[model samples]
Target: MKIQLLVLFLSTVISAFKITDGTLKSSKQELGFFESDSLRLNSTEENLSVSFKIKSNTKPNQIFVKLTNENGIESSFKPTTKKSGESYISKLSLPFTKLPTLFQASSKLFVSLVIASEEDKYFETVGSIENTPYLISKSTYKPTEKFQAKPEIHHIFNEAPQTVDPSIAVVFSFLSIMTFFTLIVSWGFNGALNFGNFKFDLSHFAFIALIIGYEVTFFFYYLGDSIFTTIGRVAILTGPTVWFGSRLLNYLGELRVAGQR
Candidate 1:
């Protein structure tokens, strides 16, 4: 029995706890809707862990942690701490199930701190000193109860997002290539910086405008949260073109006037 106990002790896993190296934040979620706002406990080391501690001037007799999951399930925990000042502080250890699930449909994790603010040092039932809820991560947590799937989580993000307008991409690429060539060509005729010559000035401005136009369109289309309508996209594209085109025409008129002079 002693030898077996020795072997078990040697085989036991010990977590290497360290202070946070980076800003404490939760892991990325496969589901877009859920995000974690839970105060971080420990560094994100080999083992998953998180904790929260709060200090204030007010000392309350008691402090409590309230957690809510996507299913609207709620649970409360009392933190262990010694009074530092006027406020009672609660330090906490987080469980996995109280966090948002990776593949699960639940939207977010919420946690709040409840404290007593009354002169009697008794916590009020309503509007008791409560902290804003936190969002939790389920990456390392497991719940006592099995999680059931919600249809909406799967259904809403399931449909494939529409592909970006190919024509827009082609046009953007073409404009970039043309802008490069135009700069090279314009720079050849009128040195790299030639403000006196309106033609070269227009070429420079046109290149900048064209690049901006493409970037704005791509930014909107590529963003996951934003839905870029075809009309909205087309509208954004038109701005730079009109601006660049007008500059070109103005440059020509300037050249004609200079030639006459």
Candidate 2:
């Protein structure tokens, strides 16, 4: 019996050394989330009770419990702590309602201890406990339960645009053509086609080209192009057209004033 006790003592010392890098250092510190059935789950109260132990020289300032499920949901809570001789005992009561809704039997519970030494602050993870069997069996509701297939969706689209009567379109086209010809005839009779007073320079030529481009852009706009496209094109031409048109008008006015003089 003495030999057996000595062997057990050597095994415990070996295990402790292995955990602390083969050193008999009591300053290495130790922490544990469970020790011989320290965890309790109250089904009626819907609360989980956890007791963890930490052995450290420095007094801890805070104790936290972290719960994580297989679905990756996590929850954290602060626990109460009490000094037990040379070590500290921290206990937490976590409510089911306070935990993540997806937490299940496959969830894990982790405990952490935080210590502050002068200006230095550090935290240590005690350990993790997994395979919470009572989480599902004791629960009345399943928050992570799957549902059946969803209802089919039907889409509604706008009706296609209707076309105008071919006869009416033809009549309108004829009237448009006649009005264009009539305007040209009136302009010609009024000598509007005469460019004798206009300058034979870059400004005059650019002004005429820009005017024709502006008119053609509107004609295409009436034909099929979207309003936004036409507006963007018009905006591009507006600045240059205004500059050249202004120069042409001033030159023409100067020429008229010189003739009057």
> Which candidate has the highest lDDT of all?
2
Error of 2 at 222 (Å): 5.5
Q: Which ranges of candidate 1 are over 4 A from the true structure?
A: 1-59, 85-88, 97-105, 117-261
**What TM-score would each prediction reach against the true structure?**
0.25, 0.31
Give the alpha carbon lDDT tens digit for every residue of 1-261 in model 2. 445323322322211111111110011222333232323333434455556555655455544555544333446677676767766666666555555545545445433334344533434344444434665565454655469777898888888999999999999999999999999999999988776664469988998899999999999999999999999999989999999999988887888889931
Q: Pick the candidate with the highest TM-score.
A: 2
Model 2: CA > 4 A from native:
1-164, 190-192, 216-232
For all candidates in order, the CA lDDT equals 0.45, 0.57
> In order, what is each prediction's RMSD in angstroms?
29.6, 20.9
Residues forming the 10-long window of minimal summed lDDT in candidate 2:
16-25
How many residue pairs of model 1 clash at the backbone?
A: 12
Clash number for every model? 12, 0
